[model samples]
Target: MPVTSAALLLHHGRGADAHVLIAHMGGPFWARKDERAWSIPKGVVEPGEDVEAAARREFAEELGVPAPDLPVRDLGPFRYTSGKVVHVLAVEVPAALVGSPDDPASPDLTTRPGTSTAQVEWPPRSGRRIDVPEVDRAVWFALPRARPLLVLGQQPVLDALVAATTP
Candidate 1:
């Protein structure tokens, strides 16, 4: 059986004009890479657990906040080159939770980011544990802008999200 993972895709706006929230993966290996390195807030589904619940838990673990209690829709069991079957739930981040998109300094992103920090031993055995943010940062991007930056494997979720809201 392929490894299964669950993710949450938080989007906002109407129809074709939506923007989705995504995160940059953490750790030294991903530090310098930008294109094709970021990922949705997600994780492996443990035995017998509900996929949506797991997605919510992973969101909280990765971003440090409970996912807003809202209606969620399935995007896909998008299969990746790595053989991970990613099941995703998407919901529009309520307008009440966001600030103006033009203001980069605004703190009202639908979901707050970066509390599930991780620790790693850098230099491959230097014995120094370095703490890093699991999801170093997050951004809300329109599909055009996000397609180029997201991990290729997960792009289908974006397409599905757009399709779901499109007329």
Candidate 2:
């Protein structure tokens, strides 16, 4: 059976004005990519671990900060082409936690260095291993803007979020 993953979709605002927090994948492969290179902060769920807990854990690990203590709504699971089922939870963070989307250098959006790292084979199958930050940076983007930036497989989570949040 494929491993089940979980993700935390952090957003602020409502309806057409909503924005979501997404992370740019780290390492050489993703270095020059922009569109389809970002993803919601996510990770594998440990056996017997609560899905929501794992989502929050991944958010902290990937972003290098604790997820805001806000009520999270389960947006449910989305299946990736790789067969991994990522359970998604959505949280509406305060403006203080999001800062200004126009300013990428906003302190609230900045992640501390050295908190998130991943081991990867640099030149695919070359047996050369390298350590890279799991996520180079995180940014807040309005819903429409975030759509094209997110990985194709995970785009549905945005739809799920809209459906779950819309009246």
Candidate 3:
């Protein structure tokens, strides 16, 4: 079976004013990149884990903060061209949880210091290894503004969010 993952798309507001939380992928490869360098908080679904539970767990792990206890709208599963299937769920978070789109420096969306980390071969095949945070920082961006910044494979997940919340 293809690998399955789950994500939680955290958004605030509605319509054109809506903003979603996205993390800047950590490590050297993504450090200097902006476009297509951000992603929804997600991870693989462990064996026998409930999809929703996995999404929530991944959100907390990646952000280093527990997700708010709120109802979520299922955005369903999206299969990327690489054959990875990601189950996405979205919740409208409190306005206070998201930083102002006009103020990138606002601390509202900052991740805690103890966020999850991953080990990788620093030079890609080199003998050196380094541990880096899974996501260095997270912020809020308007829906349209977030499109170009997201990983191509996950752009569809954003689309699903738009459709589900459009009404």
Model 3 C-alpha lDDT per residue in residues 44-63, reported as the tens digit of each score: 99999998899999988887
Candidate order by lDDT, decreasing, is 2, 3, 1
In model 2, residue pairs whose N, Cα or C atoms come closer than 3 Å (at least 3 residues apart or on different chains), thus clashing, are none
- How far residue 17's Cα lies from its native spot in candidate 1, in Å, is 1.1
How do these models rank on TM-score, best leading?
2, 3, 1
Q: Write the per-residue lDDT of candidate 2 for residues 64-147, one digit (tens) a residue.
A: 777777789998988889998989999887766545433222223224753578899979999999988888888889989999
**Model 1 agreement with the true structure over 11-42: per-residue lDDT tens digits:** 88856688878888877868899899778889
Off by over 4 Å in 1: 100-114, 118-121, 124-131
Which residue pairs collide, candidate 1?
none
- TM-score each candidate: 0.83, 0.90, 0.89
- Candidate 3, after superposition: displacement of residue 9 in Å? 0.4
| Model 2 spans > 4 angstroms off | 100-114
Q: Each model's C-alpha lDDT? A: 0.79, 0.82, 0.82
